[model samples]
Target: MIAARILDPDSKLATTRWWSTTTLPDILGVNDADEDDLYDAMDWLLQRQSHIEKKLAARHLTEGGMALYDLSSSYFEGTTCPLAALGHNRDGKKGKLQVNYGLLTDDRGRPVSVSVFKGNTGDPKTLMPQVRKVKDDFGIKTVVLVGDRGMISQKQIDEIKGVDGLDWITALKTDAIRKLADDQGPLQLGLFDERNLFEFTHPDFPGERLVACRNPELRKLRAYKRKSLLEATSLELTKVRAMVGRGKLAGKDKIGVRVGKVIDKYKVAKHFVLNIKDHHFDFHIDTEKVAAEAALDGIYVLRTSLAEERISTEDIVRNYKNLSQVERAFRSMKTMDLKVRPIHHRLENRVRAHIFLCMLAYYVEWHMREAWRPVLFCDEDQARKKTRDPVAPATRSKTALEKVHSKTLADGSTVHSFQTLLKQLSTIVRNRCRVPTDGPNAPIFDVVTTPTVEQQRAYGLLETIEV
Candidate 1:
């Protein structure tokens, strides 16, 4: 099941047909197994999920270490699964039912465990159970949890505060950060002039450290995006105004409805002011609001319970930004690498099992990526990631850029993406042969194709890792 997901992801029925053409049937000793057998195996896998997750947690996690947690929802294809419910659709599949699942990973973003929740479950509501699982199931005590602002809101942080030996690192929400930059707030814009990062404290958050960072590049990008959105919204509003002027669109209700669509489409309603009267409509950019928003463009505040003596400000920001790793995992699972969406399972447990299987498959892929970095397009100089300025946007190493431009490794081997590398490996085949002079009952022999130099290099690299 895992091999099918890793090599060529598909539904159980499709997987059965696909794997039959490979050597997996003979190698894994499931030559006669059908789709039913695979489903039964999923059932069996679900029963042992806790045991498997516990083993994973033991391997990657440690006491007083940091763990990253995040939740994402995938759209469901069928209506029968009870876990599927209508709620926030991250997959952009409007009106579709989805199931939310929380992923817990080590500080480096190696997936440790996954828990499924109803689609309607809020992000903050999923935090407590994972905290309990890490502490109770995984036996990791005194751990620092890292989550995004949405996941570790004030209410969730309040709950986590009561738990002994539990701490967290998360950014302040936009509103919270805005309040910090208010006239009377402790945060100062001048602090960032000398350096992109600075630390400060406020009475509102006692005994917790706040790390403020401003990325010039991020600030400029946000400014550009906001300008584009404002212009687009204005253009649409101008069309509506023109319609109202030409008598093509009249009535206050009609004009208001048309204006609302433009505002919602661009989502820049806050930066615009509108006036709609009978057969008249006019709108203007709210410059004050736009300037206020742009002032905090590249700025963000990270809040953490750990003291400076425990973890540095740079490390805190880097750890919070590592949530991108979890996002990458979700992209791979939902899109192509695993095909975890469009779930065919009607039973709730079956759906859970399917997601768990994909998580396990990703766990293997993560290790493969780390081991195959020498030959892949991935950057090999990971040590710099920890030492570089966390506030600045990440840049690829010089060696990595050369590999991308040259399309080959230092030894003249070609570079490959993870998917294309797998395709290259699939060319090796095992053949059955018999002597022509022998009788019909003659013994058959197996001959496996010799791997190419590059394929052999890949195999040799993977041999050193124990995924």
Candidate 2:
């Protein structure tokens, strides 16, 4: 089933029967497992997830290696599963019941372990369990837990400090960054023009070092986004103001509600000050507030327990940015490549089993992506270029590579994405041909479809030999 998931990601278990009997039996050299077998196997695997995850960590993770952690949610269609509940839906299905799950990955973004929690679990609360799992179950000593700011609160930080040989790397929230800037005086943009990173310490967060980073490109993008939203919001607000002046909107509450809709639509409510009274409504752009925010537009602060002498600022930024790797994994698990939802499982254990199966499938897909990079649009090499600091975010490189790879090939042929390539592989079929009543035996044997040149090339890239 895991292999079926990787080979045909869009397929469900019932659809695997034909592929398994026709093709997989020849490749894997076994009788086709039925849907029930797959479900039972999933249940068995879920029961041993703890042991399996430990073995995975022992095999791939090293002591003191950085563990990147993050949380994602998937919606459930039915309400039968005990684990499904209303919560913060990362999948954007706000009214749907969902389950929150956290994934732990190694420094290179190989997933080591995953845990399912109730749908409403807060991101910060998910950290300690994962940290303990890394320390106690995986037996990884001197580990650095890297996550986004939402994963680590001040209380979580204090809890992490109590753990021996356990360190953390996470970014500060916008509020914390503002307070840091306030305490240190206004952050001079000229300093960032010379160098993008600066190190500082504050009494509020003792024993932790802060790395301030500025990206000029991010600054320009943020400024542009803010200006565009402000203009659009102003237009909407102006219409409301006209309505109020013309006496179309009489009550203060009605005018406030109209203004609120515009503010919410643009999501620039904080940048404007709105005043509403009986038969009067007006809004003024908060220039001072906007300026303050603009000053920190491209700036971000990373907080880590690693000592300054032990790690370079560039390395800190690079490691912190690897959180994007886990995020990428989540994207792969969700709608991007592997659609792990509209989950059909209604039992609690079955839900867990389904998620665990997807994780295992992704474990294989991750390696396949690396092996098949020559034929795919992957930037693993470009991302590791040593000519300059790789500390900058890799999002741009990934997007550029996606565009480059999706274009026509050098031979004027269409390029195949990873998913499309898999679809091509699925075309290779095994046929059961019956010999015409030879003697009395009436023997039958299976014949595999001859591989196309493109399929052969894909198999060669993946180092998979056709049976």
Candidate 3:
């Protein structure tokens, strides 16, 4: 199954059967296994998933290590499975039944465990079960839990604080930030001009430190986005107003619904004040509200239980930002790479088994990418350089252009991406030859293909020899 994920990520069960019979046997040096074998193996793994997760945690996690948690949803086709229901669809598949799953990863972005939950499960509710698993199932002590704002609640924080030797690192929500910035708040625009970060404490959040960070480039980007959205909203409002002036629209309820849509379309309803009377409709932008929101354009607050002396503010920001690693893992499991979607399994266990298989496949791919960095395009080395401009997001070339297709290694040999290198290695094939029959059950001879130097070097990085 791992090999199928690496070689044919977008494959379904039928395609996997073909691969096992044809391509996989040559590479793995084993007899062809049927689709039943695959299905049985998945069921067996699902039955022992808990034990497997504990073993993984024992091998990869340690005391004081960071455990990052996040949730993602995938849509299902039918309603036969009990896990499938209408809920928050992260995949943008509205009106479709979906299943939600939580993924827990180590600080290095390697997946440690995953849990399947009902589609209607809330993000904050998923954290406690994972917390229990980390403490009770994995038997890990003194580990910090890292998550986004959606995954951590005030109640959850209180619960985590009660646990001995467990800490949390999370960001504050927008409303919480606004409350912190009330009268004589610690966050001020001027403080950002002198330095990007400031440290403070809040009465409500006792025994915790807050780190406020500002990005000038992010401020400019937000300002531009706000202006564009406001303009679009204004244009929409003008159209509605003209309709009212021309006597095309009437009735208070009708105008209210129409104006509501205009404001909702651009998501700037809070910035606009709508007035509706009999046969009259008008709207105006609340400049004070707009300015107040603009003041917080680039500001973000990170709350943590760790003391300033234990971990620097910069390191705190870096660790919080690493939540993007979990996001990247989701992207890989979704459309970005692994395409673990459009689930057709009807049984609940089968659905869970399918997602589990995808997670396991991703685990193998994660290690493979790290081991084959010399022949693959790794983003870690270039991440710092890419973040030099805070406003612009980093981008990599989707298609290799002729000018920058290959990279030159220290030995002066050209290397390609892992996918491209795999394609190069696929040229080596095994041939079967018939030898003269010495006895009744004579063994047949097999001739192995000679691997090119490039294939040899690529395999060498993985600490394996070409077959």
How much lDDT does each candidate structure score? 0.92, 0.81, 0.80
Q: Compose the digit string of candidate 2's lDDT tens values, residues 264-338.
A: 888988999988998899889999999989989988988899987777777888888888889888898887766
**lDDT of candidate 2 vs native?**
0.81
Q: Highest lDDT: which candidate?
A: 1
Candidate 1 Cα outliers beyond 4 Å, as residue runs: none
Model 3, position 122: C-alpha lDDT score: 91
- The runs of at least 3 residues in candidate 3 whose Cα sits more than 4 Å from the true structure, single-residue gaps closed, are 10-12, 26-32, 379-415, 432-448, 464-467
Question: Clashing residue pairs, candidate 3?
Answer: none
**Model 2 bad stretches (over 4 Å):** 10-13, 16-22, 25-32, 183-186, 380-387, 391-415, 435-443, 464-467
TM-score of every prediction relative to native: 0.98, 0.90, 0.88
Ranking according to lDDT, highest score first: 1, 2, 3
Worst 10 residues of 3 by lDDT: 394-403
The true-versus-predicted C-alpha distance at residue 388 of model 1, in Å, is 0.8
Best by TM-score: 1
Model 1, position 92, has a per-residue lDDT of 90
The ten-residue window of minimal lDDT in model 1 covers 435-444
